[model samples]
Target: MLKKSHLLCLCFSSTLLSGVAIAQNAVIVNGKAIPKTQLDKLVQKSGQPDNPQVRDQAREMLVTRELIIQEADKRGVIQKESVREQLEQSRVGVLVAAVFEDYVEKEGVTEAELKATYESMKSQYSGKEYHVEHILVEKESDAKAIIAQIKSGGNFEDIAKAKSKDPGSAPNGGDLGYVNEKSLVPEFSKAMVQLKNGQVSD
Candidate 1:
């Protein structure tokens, strides 16, 4: 027969053992302890057997998260003003994104407007085309001489291939590919725009 104190100790030990057993049997993922039923629900939601690779990945992510939490605990980061401010900012960003998405869904561009816009910009979408030849020289006089030769019926492409100072374009007879208005320097673009088909510019 046990004394009252011994009986009390036995009850306490039993309670502690039960708690340890519960903890040992629990499944923790990403810092949250989940019951077996909950894990089964998750597997059902995923519509597949929680494969070994997937379980390993989940365990790895949980371990990494625990490490981060432990380090943050040691550093007392949760109480920092910057952390609070960043959390608030993130909440504000979420709210803003939700509002913007709602606005877009409610007021999306009309089909008519889209078609009109496409028609208006159709000519601007010309396919890749290049029919340009140029000669570059260190001296402006040499450039002018080459332009004069081109004007006097000399083949500009041939002359550029033989005489242009720009090594990259010279090898290709100075034939740079189709460039839009924004692709060249302002002065170069202005000069190119003024040229007609087969015309040479100074």
Candidate 2:
């Protein structure tokens, strides 16, 4: 009993309703399909409970974002020069990071390389080391007297404690502890390197 135009109108309305229902089931926005995986990822990133309420909130956020993106695309905002440059820069940054990560995974440091580096650096720290002591005096005669006294079996540490003028070493019986040759003056280094173990330098 319906006229021809009414039948056509009914068919068109049915088609539009069918399209809208399909879009709702697929979570489409402006004909763009938004996957469920995206919602899962967003929920995981939010660090919230995986309950229905959280999922609904995340879905809403994604839908709103998609709407904004679609509007931006419609206005040609994405085609602007500055926006394109920024997008390119972001893409390059991501690519560079991925490349470095891949390179590290494929060509990482080996134990042999580490050992070689250690060997190469070892020599710099392997030079001569010395433990030394001294009795500082202003007069040559006093020095000779102290050395003669030590040579005659007088306790060198006791004599240094009593007479050495160096405030830094005097309190510890003139103990200089262990030192590297490079750290000493040339004259001291020469004298220290020449002495045998347990021998005192005059």
TM-scores of the candidates are 0.36, 0.39
Candidate 2 per-residue C-alpha lDDT over 1-202 given as tens digits, one digit per residue, 9 for 90 to 100: 2465673221111111245454444266656667767888898999988998998788778777877676667779899987888799999999999997897699997889779989876754579777788888999999999999999999988999899998778777888998877777889888889999889888
Error of 1 at 186 (Å): 0.5
lDDT of each prediction vs. the true structure? Answer: 0.65, 0.78
Clashes of each: 0, 0
lDDT of 1 by residue, 1-202 (tens): 2465673121111111145555452345334454445444445566656886665454444445555665566678878887878889999999999997897699887789779989766655554444566678999888878778888888877998899887668878898867665556788878888888877787
> In candidate 2, where is summed lDDT lowest over 10 consecutive residues?
8-17
Query: What residue pairs clash in candidate 1, if any at all?
Result: none
